[model samples]
Target: MAESENGATQPQQPQQAPKMNVLAQFVRDLSFENILSQKGAGGDVQPDVQVQVNLDAKKRSVENQYEVVLKLKVDSKSKSNGAQLFLLELDYVGVFNIENVPEDQLHPFLLIECPRMLFPFARRIVSDMSRDGGFPPLNLEMIDFLALYRAEIQRRQAATQAEASNAPTQ
Candidate 1:
């Protein structure tokens, strides 16, 4: 409550600092596959490994809080022989409490920042799974989430433009 200059009482807006909190995090799904399981290591199989990564986020509003779930998928294949050496898929979820952030900025923040916070753990899981599956430890390099986000946006824009151009003109 605030008092006006004329001595009349009035309601004041609540003050809140911008904040983001991780309420909880969990692995919703995980899968690991070793395609060359039957064929034991016979010779020096120089691994021609290929890796792919993808990210997604969704916001769930529960009362005053928001839950941001980050979904990630990683796949590895041997390019030399076109065999999938290993495939890893994981859906890591994070429940976040977001406050005071502008609507325009929320989407980027959720997709970029939240995934950054979750990547190390996911990387560890991938590394461990590869080693435990009787292969050398896979040390995943750091991901550039911002660059990835930008690329995705550009791709979407290009696709939209292509669709619009292909539509029947009025």
Candidate 2:
């Protein structure tokens, strides 16, 4: 209850922070590698970065938290000397609480928001590592989370519809 302008008592707003029935920020996996390739082991050179990103979401059995893992593999070789400069593999993860969320919402949260949060940190690591490793920094291309999420959702829905159509008639 609250006091009104005229001194009348009124109902008060409810207390307690809104329950975020979603995943909080967390890390499921992280790896930074600076491995020199076979060709560059004995030579001086810069690595050509080839970055591959794989995204997926899985539920944790006990706590019900979802783990979104972004696997990045960077393969680089020297342009001048044709030597292996650095082959970096970064497996980044964002732990999200996904309780009480619908299936459609879950996909968006994992594909878009989770990756958006993790990308900057991962980008910094890759850039800094190459800079400190005696080579030009590698700048990764920006990821399109919206497109990816839509594709995944469409793919899942299609599969679901197909399965339903193929079911035995009652």
Instruction: State which candidate has the highest lDDT.
Output: 1
Task: Estimate TM-scores for all models.
Answer: 0.81, 0.60
Instruction: Give the poorly placed runs of model 2, Cα more than 4 Å off.
Output: 1-47, 62-64, 80-82, 150-170
List of clashing residue pairs for candidate 2? 1-12, 2-10, 22-97, 23-96, 23-97, 40-84, 48-77
Task: At residue 94, give the lDDT of candidate 1.
Answer: 77
Instruction: Write model 1 residue lDDT over 62-125, tens digit each, in one string.
Output: 8435555555555555556766666777777777777787889888888788788888887788
Off by over 4 Å in 1: 1-17, 40-42
lDDT of residue 133 for candidate 2: 66
Cα lDDT computed for each candidate against the true fold: 0.74, 0.70
Q: Count the backbone clashes (under 3 Å) in each candidate.
A: 0, 7
